[model samples]
Target: MSPATQAMQREDTQNPAMLWIANGQQLWHTAPKDSNGKSCAACHSDAKESMRSKAAGFPRFSAPAGKVITLSQQINQCRSNAQQAAALPQESAELLALEAYVALQSRGLPVSPSRDPQTRQAAARGQKLFTTRIGQLNLSCAQCHDNNAGKRLAGALIPQGHANAYPIYRLEWQGVGSLQRRLRNCMSGVRAEVPPYGAPDLVDLEAYLAQRAQGMPMETPGVRP
Candidate 1:
């Protein structure tokens, strides 16, 4: 990481994304009225300790869901099942804020998933998707993100397209966004049919990314140019 980028992540005051973190903190304690006033805090106190490294092991298989799910999806399911609350709408500000908060807790942690056997099929599909060429441009993720990483495309430098740092604050977007948003943007860049948010392919790709980024530190709410 650049010195400037490292410094940016170190402080809350300089990071505008901290607003979402604060909102997430508030929501953490917001009593769930539907489930006898229970709340996240009531179950898990102080996310800093309770959720340490939790986001690193994501895209986990849930027998109940019958497929892999991301940390964001897991959060929504938890609210519905544990608190008897309606699930948060996908890509909603509240959901993003909450996701940012949880993912932040895993900062500097390694990407590690249980890799349940049930999820192998999805992961395999994701591997194929990452390497396959598609769309009008017929560009695969590896073409730029792997094959020519660190080289210039047009006027911009291409990184290895790791998902280690996500829910990032992009200078272009002028706000924080989840990794799926970034993936969708990349899909558009390749002129591929952008996957709808929460699509199985997106989830699978996320799983592949988690494995691809294994041992890399989680840098949630990251800043990007």
Candidate 2:
């Protein structure tokens, strides 16, 4: 990123994502319309205390869901099971805002996905997908993000493809977006079939990425160009 962009991200006042964060903070305390008069705050109280380091362990196995799930999925589960509310639509502004708020609580914490057997298996599948060639370009994720990182592609730098900074403000999108959205963008770039949001394969890929980025500090609500 350029120096100006970096400065914008570092300062909360200058960060556009902070708007979503602020909305999320409000949502945390306000009960959903379909809820039984319960908000996230009703159970967890202060997020600063309840949600610390929580984002590090996501894309993990969920006993209730019987599969590996992303932080967004878990949030929806909580809404359904605990609040008796409908799930938020994937990529919705409200959902993204909530995710950004939750992730902010874990900023600077290390990535620490669960070590359960199910999670491990999902990560393995993700690794295979990462290496497998696909689409019209017949390119794998490793080709650009691993084999040719720092090289120019379409006049932009090809980053190393870490998943630490997510729900980020992308200049390209002019808004904050999830890791899954970014994954879909890559799939499209390769002219591959883009999976629907919340697909198991995407969740598996996230599991692998969290493991790959283990020990790295989270930079939630990050800014990128």
Candidate 3:
């Protein structure tokens, strides 16, 4: 399901993820192992001032990788090079909490997908993937998310394949990161052969999702079921 569908409207004062956000705030300011001994705050102090608005613009292309990358991947990369901390495993609590923290920083900002011509082409490629069926079940993403949106599958409402809030703490996965992980789950559920992470198709698909979510608020590391 899309995060939009997963999101339960609530008073900002009663947000459940607020505690995790506080944890993230502390982690950002607290120094890590002394090997480098530099906190994320040491270099980038004040997330609200330095990182808040920036969180709205992500899942963007990276010149170094020559492909678009998600926010968590970027954060792990920074932790490795900047803080000398080992890369947090995917779905790990550290990663999830951090993702939630960063996402919460941009709670009200609008999502901005890439607009470069290259981005459009990438999104087009993703659209093709969304509509194509390449596995034993012969079902496409459109089968459930697009065509069957709002329908129930195993008691859960199928939602539009929106990528507005990612790196979410899903009740299923119980961790946080890009929607690609969820995509892989959907492919497996449909008896499809899942591609390796960071594959070309997934990159294209990410581009496509970013475009689809254009102008929607980015809520990362969100909680969902």
Sliding window of 10 residues with minimal summed lDDT for model 2: 1-10
Write candidate 3's Cα lDDT for 107-224 as tens digits. Answer: 7789877665666778899989989986788999888888899989888878787877766656565444457788888888888888976677877887788777778876654666
Model 2 residue 179 lDDT? 98
For candidate 3, report its TM-score. Answer: 0.83
Q: Estimated TM-score per prediction?
A: 0.93, 0.98, 0.83
In terms of lDDT, the poorest run of 10 residues in model 1 is 31-40
Per-prediction backbone clash count: 0, 0, 2
Off by over 4 Å in 2: none
Best by TM-score: 2
C-alpha lDDT score of every prediction, in listed order: 0.84, 0.93, 0.73
Residue-pair clashes, model 3: 2
- Candidate 2 lDDT over residue span 100-157, tens digit each: 9999999999999889999999999998888889899999999999999999998998
Looking at model 1, residue 67 earns an lDDT score of 80
- Tens-place lDDT per residue, model 1, 99-213, is 8898899998888855787566677778899999988999999898889998887887788988977777777888888889988988998788997989999998888888888
